[model samples]
Target: MRNFMSKKLLILSEVFHPENFVINDLAMHWAEEGCECEVLTRVPSYPAGMPLKGYRNRIYQKTHSFGLPVHRVGIVSGYQRNLVRKMLNYMNFCFLTTMMLLFRGNRYDRIFVYQTGPLTVALAAVISRMLYRQKVIIWSQDLWPDTVFAYGFRKTRLRMVMLNVFVKWIYKRCDIIMVSSEGFIDKIRKMVPGSEVIYVPNWPDINCKRVGIKSLPEGFNFTFAGNVGKVQNLRNVLAGFALFAEKNHPNAWLNIIGDGSNLKALKSLVEEKKIPNVNFTGFRPPNEMPSYFAASDVLVISLNDAPLFELIVPLKFHSYLTASRPIYAIVNGEVTRLVKRYSLGVSADPSDIESISGGFERLYYASQTELKNYSANAAGMTRNGYSKEKNIAMITSILWPSEIGLKQADLHRAM
Candidate 1:
């Protein structure tokens, strides 16, 4: 770690402000800590491939937000559902950012790579190091190749070889690698032997207190919020919920509050099944989520039963805990482990329709006392160690121990 007064940190990510990434919060906090922070990212385009209405893909643009300087670079559009187009977008960002950094990125003392997706983004950091020799620290949210495969790409011999080589090269070059899940540690070690890997789970960005209550449809409500994508495995969740409704709870309702590529297909499935009492409320902003959670009897967090997904504890999980709502988790591995260990709620294998249906049934029939117990455990767990302040402090400790100037005891005492 270096002193904050002199150290200038550059943040690289594909998404930033106007896109609802936690990176915005991290950058703001770092700036507040006295470091001169700069962000190099593309014009806000996420969840949807088209750029936000007010922004355009200029060759290069500069602006300031939350007390930090931000550089926006050119990006290819029309990539959400098309793999070829997506690669073009990643390649375009890498090319444009690499050129800019090679010329103007020499001043930063250190660089932080916010690795969200597409390992190709590593090219920007790699180029920075090769040309400017800046130390690169990576905080990877999603593991590559496995994530790539989970996106429905077939793993061929040639493709696997290229992906492994790319992943290893990127991991080997980073000064430090921080993963958002403990389950990602072994894979990082296997991919890059001797790499310094640290676990830093995600924290909820919004406050937990219910801002307002919603008038929900007449029924026992179960709400699933956030990105309604294929990875969420909503098709199966709907199927299971349909089964649960048909057999167990006719008055049960599932409220979905988000949008994504699968939204159309999911809506189509609901219609085909004639699934009654299922409501799609589209996407809601972070601040308004509490009201939705408050309106629900149970909040759901789910994912596809992919190898990569098993390792992830989604960001929504933290928010769900903070909301103090009993969770119906259609997930496996680490997420399931946490739910079971903390007694947060019921868990089911994402691939098993019967298992998911049973989970809904179990939660629906759970005694009010039992439900209260789950909510209490969730609130208690967050207070102990999972707050946003604790998570940010943990990252600071790993990324800038000398700058923070606190020993382990001092850090704990401060928290």
Candidate 2:
């Protein structure tokens, strides 16, 4: 391999800084490793669907964050509330990013496309690989088409065929395909049989800082943090929590800490049901999550009963493990398997209200020793392998094998 320090690394993604995405951390890590890392992305507007304060959607914007240069092309402003607008935004991003790559003469040794959302953004990477002979690596955080349907899109044979064809094109161009979940391995390999598909789990948001426990609501709190979206199956969570509060634990409280597209509807449901002991704390910064998690008795993770979810290990699960709080996993498949395997916490079916209630009951009434055991398991899992450092090492090995190998040896020696 060529000298890592001399390598120019470019990251192409629709979401980057100012949006709570993990690619920011990776770009910083590569810069620290002495690579001339740069990120080509859109003006930061995501989850909220509007440009963040102090940023405007410009034709072209150049900035730096944590020592790495970020080049923002066009803006795909509001899409969080409306589907039509969302599609338009995605298309706009794809068009602008593709155009920039075609015109920009900046050379890079390798290009990494953070295929966290739409596979359409990979067009830039594909162009780079095909036109410039650059190595392209994709770290897929969400499976395409499957995720499209998961978002409530109607699936059809024609749609499936078209998406399959598009997905194959994207996968074929990548030198290496990395998935954030182990369950995504077979599916990806089946699409690109000869491509190297590796399992590289995502770490918790690197921006999160561990803080001392802060003041929390009265009574035992079961906290569900992060995006409050339909895919989270939050309706079932609210229903199950209501049942648990009414029937078994009157003093227990359900705290939802995040904001998303489903926030308004969810609030309406809460008002309609007049569910007691429920509090909604709109989104908070990542740095504040540690204190919030520390204040809670148990952390909850729930996802809708969809085939796509069965193959996912949500990023929040990783953050929950780091919090060392006993988890109540109202999810199925790989998430359930890992929770049970490691004795992280209780697991239940997301679609079954009664089952979810039972899961909450089990955790709320669990003995201190039992809770300690679960907490210990959570810590053990993170330390054993699932960590930001480990994930970065896995990716760096693929992108800059010789250099990262030397860096790892130095790290081991320093340790």
Candidate 3:
């Protein structure tokens, strides 16, 4: 076993604890294992534009949590609705994180970046590598240039050229690039040839437990949990459910859990369309997700029908699998392939409303034997394929190669 006792590590992320993300659990686990760890991140403001409770948006502040020192930088408020403020928020974190690292870059032996969005966040790590020559590893949750355009940015000639150049520059500078989806490997290699890209998928962060509380009322329930953003494609989901409810399953309910920028808009859409049996529950505590999942008859996962989205797997996939509920996947590409291959659930194209309605109909009429088989397959997949301990050990081994006695060639071959 590798001893993390003496290793000093730094984690850079735009979101951390106080805002739910897998990075929070990963950092805490490393600390408990006796690694000296610290974080450089923004003040807690995500999904919601304002600062979270017990926190004020400050220029810079230091706090400790879960045995790790956390250094936070300020972000522009009200970015949830304003495009300009959102751009500024991304820019502010990039500039401020660079400044923070310029002074303290040499303190840590290595740096790990938990990149969720905006490739610009990795610029600071790239700059640190140029200045301090530390090993920098980034776990890329989003692909740049493609993601930039996917999020509604116009791909002007000048903008495309600049983004291509910026993406290559940032990625090529990193010592190692880790991706959460296997599909990201080829795409990233196409961007930066010869770059060491490794597939390190995210494990489930939610602890699946049987709780006595009935979070949802009786009757068959289909729950969609997580952010309610445009990229989540909930509008299409709602429309499909409306079609299904009108014709086939009138008593079936669709529960939209959690909150995001699109929550109000979705509620408006529900009222505008008069979609029945649809409940919009605002944000719920992370600890309470198990109960909601436990109460659900089937879990829904969807994303916009974009090529960029095809290569990504949302963290909620693993969480839903851990809950051992059959999935109703309104998605395409990787998630769809997985669902069909493993017999985990039924799937439909995100862009096709009729197909989605058919998926709901199929799940609604599925026999108890079929549902149990799906549930058993999901539980087995979570235990065998997405084992948290195995994934974490793989990451830590790569992070401290010498401690684990892994040669560079062997590490590449292991992946």
Candidate 4:
């Protein structure tokens, strides 16, 4: 068998450690598994869009995380709420990373692009492929043209044509295009005909240790963890909870347990509407997430009612399932289907306040035995479909097939 450990690997991502992303854990795990891995990414300025303490926005800087060497490029600050800055942030990463790869392209045997944000970040890998002929694999967490349009971009005919062409150009260059959702495969295949597309879903990267948190209020807690962005539909979630509270679910509380651009507005809405029993615990660490989940009766996952959202499954879904909490899926499409099909929890439409209120009532009145069944079902689903060990092994085999004595055909069959 070929010794894959002798090969050097480069991970290209827009986000990494200190930014609370799955790419951080994946890189650390690869290093632990004896892979000679290094990371090239932008400086940590996510959600808040400012450099983390102890770091600066420099043209070029080097850092280390868990003993893994990290290369950082400067990013445009204040992109969190500014549209122009956000565009610049994406363009800046694409420009700097492309230039860096052009000079140091020959050092690695393969390049792995952990694509989370703009697809433009993958341009560097495409450039390296052309110049150094290195094998490139992209794990696309977000789809491009659809996301671009979904996020308030004007979809003119000319713009759509240009965007489609650009997407195809980047995707066609990669050796394999791995998608986080099965629904993405069809859309991506249509975009780049004959392109190699693989489905490699995300797993729970957080350590779910149920530590005790004394600050939790005395009530049946319904916790919403992760980013509190506009797309998360927090406004409607709050409205639904308020309606349920008005109907005399006095002991029920809604806990919003993360920070984002929409957090300030959501807090303002809470104060303005005089919403009762709603608590905003701003930006807790990932290590403390399990404790919050432990104190909760149901974990809530929601997204805006949009066609684009239906085609993607958020990473929090896996984390919630791993936490083994009864889910309250107040969203549409894929997540709702999963919750109902597996009996993991209850589902409601995100755009409908009444539906969400009804879901709350149902869960509030559910017997302890029924809630336990939901938790049990969630655990079973995680073990069977979202197993961290199994998915990571599959990824490793795809990256270094020779080490496992597997061919491309065998890998496809395994998938």
Model number with the top lDDT: 3
Q: Enumerate clash totals for all models, in the order shown.
A: 0, 0, 0, 0
If both were scored by lDDT, which would come out higher, candidate 2 or candidate 4? Answer: 4
lDDT of each: 0.85, 0.85, 0.90, 0.89
Give the per-residue lDDT of model 3 (tens digit) for 1-415: 4264486889999999878788887887798888988999999987788899999889999988787899999989988877899999999999999999999998988899999998898998889989989899999999888898888888899999999999999999998999999999998999999998999988897767755565675789999999889999999999999999899566799999999988999999999999999988899877789889989999999999999989888999999999999999898889989999999999999999999999999999999999999999999999888898888878888888877778768877776
The TM-score, computed over Cα atoms with residue i paired to residue i, of candidate 3 is: 0.97
Q: What is the C-alpha lDDT profile of model 4 across 1-415, one tens digit per residue?
A: 2256668899999999988777776777788877888899999987679998889999899999978999999989888877998999998998999999999989988999998878998999999999999989999999888998877788899999999999999998999899998889999999988998999988886877765673667989899999999899989999999999998877899999999989999999999999999989998878888888888899999999987788878999999998898999988888888899999999999899999999999999999999999999999999999888888888888888876788989989998
Deviation from native of the Cα of residue 191 in model 1, angstroms: 1.6
Tens-place lDDT per residue, model 1, 211-295, is 6676778889999999888889999999999889889577899999988888999999999889988999987777788888888
TM-scores for every predicted model: 0.95, 0.94, 0.97, 0.97
How far does residue 343 in candidate 4 sit from its true spot (Å)?
A: 1.1
List candidate 2 stretches off by more than 4 Å. Answer: 1-3, 206-208, 211-213, 402-415
Whichever of 1 and 2 has more lDDT, that candidate is: 1
Where does candidate 3 stray beyond 4 Å?
1-5, 210-212
